[model samples]
Target: MEENNSFSIKNWNEDDRPREKLLLKGRTALSDTELIAILIGSGSRNESAVSLSQRILASVSNNLSELGRLSIPELMEFKGIGEAKAICIAAAMELGRRRRTGEALERKKITSSNSVFEYVQPIIGELPHEEFWILYLNNSNKIIKSAQLSKGGITGTVVDVRLAFKDALQLGAVGIILAHNHPSGTLKPSQADIQLTKKLKTAGDSLDIKVLDHLIITEKAYFSFADENML
Candidate 1:
């Protein structure tokens, strides 16, 4: 999927170009493609970075949203995207996704299950399969760190609550949030989800660390067991 454009960035009037736009309007004003062009740094012999970015977006079904969801290996399918560029794109996309949550995450500390979803959704919501992850928090309820506890079938994935606690203890985490994705886009908490939360809660109780919430993320939304008083 290639569109031949006789006019490249060099042909465009410099004042209206993306680099100029960045300097003038600031980065927030640029679209995803425009930001991507800056990261690309250069295009092929015949094209400019902005042109390359346009072509890359076109190749990915003309969807910048889908491009935001691309895995590193999937991004490498582009002709000029080597390791560094691919990682740069991945990181930028991640940061952009996180920013979409608006200012709620910053105005106040996370207090409930929905708040936990706000943090985890950016990192794993777009995934097509399950990823069970844990957010370790300090006594203040601020997240200290996060780690993938397991990755497999959502309901049947092996989880060792003891091992999870061990990791949290090592980080001196005083609380934790359990998060996992539902590729089927259903937010309903499965029996397995409930069971896992119970295990984590019991373990946290023993360690004097609170289990903040257990979030079930779907493609478009999430469910919080704690919010529903289920946890």
Candidate 2:
């Protein structure tokens, strides 16, 4: 207990060391702290790597997503976590995020608001400011390409209608979905949001491109203009 907490990995029983345990039982057998300890490589004189990792997780409420949000500097503030360890943890988290994004992009179709939410959430939902994106889709509604059209302050972003349509044309897309994130996490669409949806829909109509939906996304939920009959 206390002995385990104070001792370094070298002093731990072979099976209890993170790397050894992982090799013996597979990655799934290692706890979050153990996996993080492995990334950290070592610990300070006052605590074992596992114990230090436990403290790091505690600082973020044991939420891995929250941990993933930490910058390298923020991670380095933890005892026993130097620049190398901090970068390792941050890089690992980023790789996981990219993997999820790649998986979302590989889906065959954009069939529902929920599907849109899953695809774009990793890209923009948790942003601290507003950003606008357009998903260009083929006639079958499969996403051909997605692009960020603008980024702005907390309240809103400017959407360039012509540029968005130009990208859609270049992609040979027959339809598009508009998306933006509200950093404040409120699902309610602002009056500006309503107006933008109407405007984009009208513009797409002129180009013979359907505006499939406009989604106002937050970290946890989303409001769909089409779902509410607002599009």
Candidate 3:
């Protein structure tokens, strides 16, 4: 069934309204467009909220992960999404990401690169820029803290080697896992990436801290330096 674009949801049958649909049929029964319409709240002068949401989802091929990556300004480019509406959408997306990351307790032990991905992916996977993070682990290989060392552009970040070990030394952490996201979606490490890993590992060595692995994270995959014997 095709909806009339010009008609507001107010004019539609109550059953067709996204809010009503969620109430009657439950959340799983609502489409992605309906879920997004609930976030943006309203549409432009000539369009219904549902129609505007459909256009927004269509812009990203209806991939929620892709939609999660859009910057606030990018969302504001939509016809009816002003700063407030765009902020609402971005906030909702972040909540969804955090909900996934909240399961980090289940992965407190750093067993493998895949285990690292499960805990860290939700925090950095969908970002539009670079973020360098360090996961500090006790001698038992359990996480002590995960902190962002630096935030920078798509090309790279300037991570201070001394700062990398500061938290580890304070927390009595003997193991460190380096991680950063690539918004460009490339898994291959640049010379800068490899060099930084080497430099940080050397710095950690002097402190008796083990640089266990360096992971280059993308939205759906990761490259592990330890796994590849590059460490």
Candidate 4:
């Protein structure tokens, strides 16, 4: 019952092995599969670690974002990948997600619509549903905090203007920017969107908090009310 066709990392040349190649040529020289192979350590007797890693990547169409969405149980469905390997992959992906969030949070000031888009895209743009967010800024226009005011389905979400202003007041923010994403990928603002912006601006005026802009974001592009002279 013994199978003859089997490949192992130990049987490969040192230059071809993932760990050795990484050490000799720098991490960038290793392909995605090689990098993942190093994380899981070894593959089944019938397959090399690189081959197994390739199959896993292939299952997700080689998309890292898609791969990041895979659950540990889903990864464990593959042969040679057990709880330990699955956990390792999940932990690595989570770290990457946190790193992206941290980078976005590190930006000091909001100078334009483009700056706001860059800051909020990683936080909500890629989401499959609608999310309304408010960026609270100090007198110098530096971001004090950003908070999600509401989350809804593909079509739309309800924003509580009261809660948004409450957070701004608590943070002592002198200015606020409103933003939300359309899951449909359309940048055109709805009549409701226009109405909401006007309402928020009026409320801000009463509180002495400036409503700087309202942005409608899709995955690839955005609409800025301020730039359009609608603010």
N/CA/C clash count, model 3: 0
lDDT per residue as tens, model 3, 1-231: 767684655576532588877876789998999999988777776887889999999999999998887889999998888999999998998898888898875769988999999898888877888999999999899998999999999788999888878888999999999999999999999999999999998998999999999999999999999999999
Number of the candidate with higher TM-score, 1 or 3: 3
Q: What tens-digit string does per-residue lDDT give for candidate 2 at 77-188?
A: 9978889999999999989889989999888499999999999998998788999998999988898888899999997889898899999888999999999999998999
The CA lDDT of each predicted structure is: 0.78, 0.89, 0.89, 0.88
Instruction: Report residue 158 deviation for candidate 3 (angstroms).
Output: 1.9
In model 2, where is the ten-residue run with the lowest total lDDT?
Answer: 1-10
Candidate 3 has an lDDT of: 0.89
- The order by descending TM-score is 2, 3, 4, 1
> Which of 1 and 2 is the better model by lDDT?
2
The RMSD of every model to the true structure, in order and in angstroms, is: 6.4, 3.8, 4.4, 5.6
Taking all chains together, each candidate's TM-score versus the true structure is 0.67, 0.91, 0.86, 0.81
Runs in model 3 lying further than 4 Å from the true structure:
1-16
Clash count in backbone of candidate 2: 0
> 185-228, model 1: which lDDT tens digit per residue?
88888887888789889888988988888888865688888779
Candidate 4 local Cα displacement, residue 101, angstroms: 2.0
